[model samples]
Target: MTESPSVITKRADFLAANRGLRVARPGFVLLAQPNDGKGKRYGITVTKKIGNAVVRNRMKRRFRELLRAQLPVRGLPDHDHVLIGRDGGIERAFARLAEELDDALARAAAGKGDPRRRRPARGNRR
Candidate 1:
């Protein structure tokens, strides 16, 4: 099923949790990080090294689609995500994006421990 906006978290939340997923190829890096405890929100990072707005947008679109269709199914539903687009060939193929996304999500999900658990307060420290 498609992920609801409420289920997507933002970038800040993911960073705060110290949870990240990355799959790198010669052309791009696919990354997914959990945001808030609500839903999945995403950010796309493409440097000038890739291309202009047109090219960058294209890459972003690819990543967006990959995440929209497959990411929620594979990775954590409650996380923030950032997909960095590479240059040359990696920018062109959709399958490559799909494959890398799958791999990255798998890697991120491999660690199943919860990051939200609270530690004992200083008063309880012994």
Candidate 2:
């Protein structure tokens, strides 16, 4: 029997996945990492920077649908997948987003991820 992808709800899991391979597209970023023989797991994150609650929720819904449809069959086995929303994602076409995801997954599978992004220096904050 085929097992469906599991949902990732813990903050630690998200953070751990952040250290894994990253594939960035115009709409969203896909992060995938091996989970020590665990079944496939995934998470969706849509920050307020993307939009108001309604907009953020809408993006999450769309992402959830995309992952549900693609992750089980194409996702990396025993890996954790996280989808980080981008401002462009909310306005992009679903079909286009789907295509991008497929491309991203293929890249991840082939271990051809984008270079890690540099983090800006943090100054003192109030």
Candidate 3:
């Protein structure tokens, strides 16, 4: 029987996943990394930048469904998967998001991940 992927709840887990492979699509960014044989685990984050609480919750729900459907079979085994919502993701078609996720997973499996994005420097505090 196929078990549903486990949810990632710890803050450290999310931070660690950020250091792994990154695959950016128009809708969202996929981050995957080995979890020391912790099995298939996943997390979803929708920022306030995306919208109000209602919008963010909606986005999270959609992301959760996408992960549930795809992660068990298509996701990388023994890896932690994190999906960071993007502005376009809230309105993107579910099928298209699924397609992008599949493509992202393929690239990640082949070790063909996008370059890590550099964080901008924060302005000096007064």
Candidate with best lDDT: 2
Instruction: Name the runs in model 3 displaced over 4 angstroms.
Output: 122-126
Expressed as tens digits, the lDDT of each residue in 8-124 for candidate 1 is 245555354444555555655555565546576666677787878887887777777776787557757776666666776344578876776676667667753224436799899
Q: After best superposition, candidate 1 residue 24: deviation in angstroms?
A: 2.7
Name the 10 consecutive residues with the lowest summed lDDT in model 1.
5-14
lDDT of 3 by residue, 20-108 (tens): 99999999999999999999999999889899999999989988999999888889999999999999998899999999999998898
User: What C-alpha lDDT do the candidate models reach, one value each?
Assistant: 0.62, 0.95, 0.93
Per-residue lDDT tens digits of candidate 2, residues 48-104?
889899999999999999999999889999999999999899999999999999999
Candidate 3: Cα lDDT at 63: 89
Off by over 4 Å in 1: 5-21, 89-91, 112-126
Candidate 2 residue-wise lDDT at 73: 86
Q: Where does candidate 3 clash, by residue pair?
A: none
Least accurate stretch of 10 residues (summed lDDT) in model 2?
117-126
- What is the full ranking by lDDT, best candidate first? 2, 3, 1
Give the distance in Å from residue 92's predicted Cα in candidate 1 to where it truly belongs. 3.9
| Model 2, CA-based lDDT | 0.95
TM-score of each: 0.66, 0.94, 0.94
